[model samples]
Target: MTHEEKKKEESHGRPEIPAWMRAVAEVISAPGYERWARQVAATGGCSAPVRLVGESQVIDAGTGEVLHIYRTADEPTGHLLVACGNRRGAVCPACSHIYQRDVFHLIRSGLSGGKGVPEAVREHPRVFATLTAPSFGAVHTQRERNGKTLVCRPRRGGGVCGHGVPERCGARHDGADIRVGQPICPDCYDYAGAVLWQAHAGRLWHRFTLELRRQLARRAGMSRRRFDALVRVSFAKVAEYQRRGLVHFHAVIRLDGPGGHDDPPPGWATAQLLADAVPEAAGLVQVLSPDPGNGQRVLAWGDQIDVRAIVVRGDGGGLSDEAVAGYIAKYASKGAESSGTIDRRLSCGRCKGVGTVTMARGPAVCKRCGGVGTAGGLDLDRLPVTEHARRMIRTCWDLGGRPELEELRLRPWAHMLGFRGHFATKSRRYSVTLSTLRQDRAEHKTAESRQRNGLPGPESTEVLAHWRFAGQGYTEAQEILAGHISQRAITARRIEEQRREGA
Candidate 1:
C-alpha cells in the first residue's frame, strides 16, 4: 500500500475517540465557543465541556412581548465551558482543576480572611487535625525512611491462622506493591465490620462534633446553648481513604466569637483550650447501635486521633491557610473511584452478566489466586476486596435503605456508602462559605468578561443570559482542538502570574 493509503487505513482503524474527548471537541467547535475552546485546548483537552442545545426566550419588559428566541445555533450552544459538576478525574480533568481551585480559594478565604471573612481570623487559634478509624485488622504495609526498609507486618514465628493461612507477611513491600490492598489473611480482617463502619462514619463524625461542642461548653462553665452565644466553633473537614481502605478525616477547626464573623471571641477562647477539648471530646464520644444486625456496636474515634495548633508562623507550625485550603480542595474533587471502586452504578443485570462471563461456562480460576471454582464467589481470597471496590459496594448498599434510614441517605454519594458529608465541610463561623466564594468568583468572571468585551460597567442597564444543559462531553476532532486550547490557556495564565510577580 502507498504511504497515504497506509495513513488512511491507520486513521480509519484508529480507536474510537474517547467519549470524554468527543464531548469536549463538540463544545469547542460549537457556536460562540472561541473563549471556551481556548480554555479546553489550554487544559490539553482533558475536559469535555457540557453543551446546552436549547432556546432562550427574551421578553420586552414594557410590552410583555417575546423579543427574541435564542437558539443553540444562534447563541453559544456548544461552547467549550467547564462542566460544573463532573467529579471524576477520568471524565473531566479541566473541570476538576477548576473545582479544586475553587475549593482552595474557599478554604483559604476562611483561613486568611477574604470573601468577607475578617483578616484577623489569621490570628485565631486553629488546628489541622486528622481523625482516624479504629483498627479493623492488620494488613500489609510498606514503610521506608532514609534507605531503611521496614518489615511489612512482623508477627511472631511466621505463624498460621485458624484457616491455616500465613498469619504475617515477611516480604518488604515497596511503595508500588500490588498486594498492598490485599489482606495478609482475609479471614482475620473484619470485612463486615469495616463495611458497617463506613456506613456509619458520617454519623460518627456528627456525634464527635457535637461532643466537642458540649465539652467546650462544659469546660467554659456554661450551658451548651449558652456557649453558642459566647463562642462559636468553626471547622472544615475532608474524608480521606487510608491504605487500609478505611475512611478517615482531616479537619481544620477554629474557635470564633459569637455572632459569627463580626464578633470577637471571649478572652477564654484559646488554642490550648480547644486542643484539650478535641481529644477529650473525641475520647468521650461514642455512637451506639441500639439494634445492630447481629449485636449492638459501639463506634468511637480511633486512639490515633491527632490535634495540633495551627500556628500562622513558627517551628512545628501547622498547615498554612493556603495549604489547608489547597489540600481540602484537592480531595473534594475525588470520589470513591479514587479508592478503586466503579465510578458508575452496576445494574443488577450487569452484575449478573459479569458473573456469568466469569462463572457460567465452568468454574474459572480466581483472578487473585489461580484457584478454580472461585471466580464468582465473595471470598476475599479469590476476589480480594480492593479498598476502592469495597467502599463502592458499601456506599451503594447503604444508599438503599428503608424509611427509618432515609435520614441517613446520601443520594449523590450513594456510590461512597452512607457517608454523604461534603468533601470539605466548614463550620458556619470558621471562614467564608463555599457559596459566597463561588459567587465572588462568578462576579469576577462577569466583570472580566465585561472588561474584555469593552462593555459598559456598573452604570449600564441590566444584562441577562440564560443557560440549559445541552449535553455533556466531545468528539475526537474537537478533543484535539480542546487540548491545544487548554495548553495555551495554562501557559498564558502562568505567564500572567510570572509577570505580576516580576512587577
Candidate 2:
C-alpha cells in the first residue's frame, strides 16, 4: 500500500479526525491540489496570510489591449493570499528573514558600496559604537578584570538584602545562567524606573546626536551652526533589548562632506577623530525623566561604551564592516520577544464581552486586554497574566495620562512597554530604503511573470487591480502543513545565508 494509504489505515481505530483536518485532507486530495499548493507556497507558507478578495486586469497602456484578466473566485481557495509582512521573527520568520537580508544590504551599501552608494564611503570616517543603558540595580553578572574569569559577586559577611535575596553569588555563574540579568532581589529592582527609561530612550539618542555634532564642531574650531555648513554626520542605528530588558543602541556613525556621500569629508575627519568624539559626546549628553512628580533624575549612557574603527580590507583597529553589518541586521527583526514579552499588541478583549472598548471615532480598545486599538481606560487588574508585563503596562497607562508626557504617547504603545521608536532606523542618505527594495523586487517578479507568459513589459502594460482584506491564518490541518512548509523555508534561507558568507 502507498504510504498515505498505510498511514490512514493505521489511524482507523484512532479518535475521529477533526473537521478542519478532514477539510485539509480533502483539499490536498482534490484534482487541482498541485495548483492550490503552489499558490499557497507563493506566500512562503505564512501561518497567518492576509486573504484578499478582488479582481485585476492587466492592460496594454499604449494599445489598450487586455493582456490578462484575473478574478479572486478563480483562485485555488477563492481568495488571494498575501504575506503578512511582519518584521518580528516571533511573528513571521519568513518575512523577518527577508527583512534581515534587506537591512544587511542597506547597512553594507553604506559601508562598502552598492545600490548607487559610492565606494568612497568606505574611506569616510566611520565608527561602530555601542551605547548601553545605565545600571538599574545590582544584577547577577559575570565579570573579567583582565583575561581571567572573576567571581560573579563577592561579599565579606555574605549578608542578605532587605528582600532576603543573597548579596553575593559565590558560584562561578556561566553566561547562560537564568539569573544573569535578573535582579539579585526582584523587590530591590527598580522596575518602574527601567520602564520609564525605555520610554525616554529615543530622546536620549536624539540628545546624543546633538552632543556628538557639538563635539565635532569644537574639535574643528567652529561653531555648531558653522560645522553644519561644512559637513553632515550620518548614522544608522538599531536598538537591542538586553537580558535586563533595557534597550541599548548600536550605531554606524559616519561623517561626510556637505554634499553627503558624493563629496569627501574634510582632512580633519578621520576614523580616530570620530572614535575620540564618541565617548566625549556620550559623557556630555543627558535627559531628565519627565518631572517624575517625585524628584530630579538624570539619565545618561552606562559605563560600558564601545567605539571601534571600521577599516576595510587590510588595516584593522576594531570590527570589520561585514561583522558590523551582520550584527545590526541580525537584531533588526527581533522585538519584545527577547524580553519575555508580547511582540504583537494586546487589547481589552481578554475580558471577553466586558463590553467592547469604544474608540474615539469607533469602538474603544482596552490596549493590554485586547479590546480594540484604543487604550485609554484599561484596569491594571484586567491586563495579561504576567505580573512583569502588567506592571510595565500600568506604567504606560499611568505615565501616558500625565500632561507633560502626553507627547510621548505612552498609552498607545503600552504594549511595547512605553518605547514607541522603530527597532531600526537610518539617516536620510544611509542607503536605499526597505520600501525601495521591496518595490524593485515586485517589479522583478512582474517581469519574470510577463516573460513566462510572453507578454510585453510594464512600460507598455499596466495592471489595474482591486483587493480587499478577507481573513487570516489557517485551519488546524492547514496550520500543521504550514508549519512544515515554514520549516523548509527556514532551512532554505539559512543555506542561502551560509552560502553568501562562504563566498
Candidate 3:
C-alpha cells in the first residue's frame, strides 16, 4: 500500500481482542461453564485468566451409574479459573499485591505467634543479625544521617594497597551515585576471591551454625550430641547483595526447648548466651580443603563479625519480631537477577566492547565495548568470576566438597551457585513453619470466597476444575490494569493496618 494509506490504516487500527479471550473461550467450552462465564463476563474485565476445557460426569446420589453428561459447546472442553501468582511490582500488580500481603501475614505470624506457633515465642531469645562479605576493594558509597551527607568511607589517607592505589575514599557521595559498585582500582580488588567466597558463603554459614550449636552445648556443660534433648536452636535467614555485588546475610535466631512448640526452654537459655556464642562460633569455624595447585585453602569467617543482643527498645531494640520476620519474607522472593546479574547463562564468543555486556557464544565480552578478563568473559578455563569475584575462581575448587565439610554444600540450592540454602530457614522450635502459614492463608482465602459467593455450606456437592499454563507474563493492556489493581490493594491494606494499630 502507499505510505499515506499505511499511515491511515495504522491510525485507525482495529481494536485487538483482549488476552483474556482464551479464558472466556475455555469457560464457554467447559461443562456448566456457561453459567460461570456469564458471571465472569459480568465483572467487566480481567486481563488474563486460566482457560480449561473438559467433561464432567454427573451421577445420581442413589445410583452408581452416571445420570447425565454435562459438556460445553466443545464436548471435551473444560475450564478452571485460578489466580496468577505473579509477585513482581513491575509486572502483574494484582498478583504481586496479593503475594506481598500473604508474605506480610506469613512473617507476622512467625513473629507474634499465629499459624500454629506458640505465643510464648515472643519471650524467646531472638536477635536479628546481619553478616556482610568483606570488601574486595574500595568503591563509591552513599552516606547520610539526620539529613546531612557524609564521606562514604572516611579512612585515614596514606594507606595504599599492594597495587599502590589509595586505600581510603574521600568523596562525599549521594544515594544515587552510579559508581557505587565499581571498584576504585579494579586490579587492586580480589575479584576472584570475592566470587569464590560468595559461592561458598552458604557453606560457611552452615558451618557457623553447627559450630554455634557445639559451642552452646559446651557452654551449657552438655555433650554435643545430647544438646538437642535439652534445648533446640531455630533460625531464619535471608541473603542480601551489597553495593559491591557480594551476598551478605540477615538472620533471626531463636532458642527454644527440645520439644519445639510443645515445651519452653530451660531457664539457662538467654539472648545473652546466644549472642556470645555467635561470635565465638564464627571465629572458631573453618572450612578446609586440600588444593591441588596450592597446598590447601583454609576458609574462615571474615574478621568483621558482629553479634548483638536484640532488645525491645533503642536502635537494636526497635527490631521487633514482626519486623524481622517481615524483612526475611520480603527477600525470599528475590533472585540474583534482582541485584543486576543476568538470570540466564552468558552467551559464548560475542564481544562488542566497554560499556555493554553481551551474552553470546565464544568468550563472554562487553557488547558495547569489548573488555575481556572479567567475570562475563568466555575464559571458562580460568573460573566463573563476575559478581562473586573471589569464590568462582579455579583456586577455590573443592571448597564446599571436603568430606569433613559435608554440611556446607547446601545441596538443595545448587542452582544458586554453591549458596544452596533456603533464603529463609527456621529450626523447628523457632515459632511457626512456612507451610502452616501458607495453609492458614489458603484457608482464609477459601472461607472469604465462600462468604462472598454465599455458599450454603463449607462443602460443595459438585466441584469441577481444569487448568493449564498459558504463559507467565502480561500484555500491555493487562499490565496497565494490574498496576491499578495493585495500587488499590496496597492502599487498602495500609489503611487496614493503620486501623488495627489505632484500635
Better of 1 and 2 by lDDT: 2
Ranking by TM-score: 2, 1, 3
Q: What would you estimate as the lDDT of candidate 1?
A: 0.65
Off by over 4 Å in 3: 1-107, 143-148, 153-168, 289-296, 312-318, 343-420, 448-465, 493-503
TM-scores for every candidate against the unseen true structure: 0.76, 0.87, 0.68
Q: lDDT of all predictions, in order shown?
A: 0.65, 0.79, 0.57
Superposed by TM-score, candidate 2 places the C-alpha of residue 450 at a distance from the truth, in angstroms, of 1.6
lDDT score, candidate 3, position 57: 51
| Ordered list by lDDT, greatest first | 2, 1, 3
Top-TM-score candidate index: 2
lDDT of 3 by residue, 1-503 (tens): 99999987897867766767665454446576445534333222233444434555534344344544444434232333344554443334445555555656555554567767767666767666677676656666777889988876677655877888777787887656655666777777764455456667777898888999999998988998888788888776767656566677777777778876556778898888888888888888776654434565666666776665555444554476656666666765565544434333332223211223435654453543245422355443443334333223232223433444344441222223334444555555555565675677677775775576554333433434333444433445434544455455456666877899799
Candidate 1 vs candidate 3: which has greater TM-score? 1
| Poorly placed runs, candidate 1 (over 4 Å) | 1-46, 55-71, 75-82, 88-90, 145-147, 290-293, 314-318, 347-414, 451-468, 494-503
Query: What is the C-alpha local distance difference test score of candidate 2?
Result: 0.79
> Between prediction 2 and prediction 3, which has the larger TM-score?
2
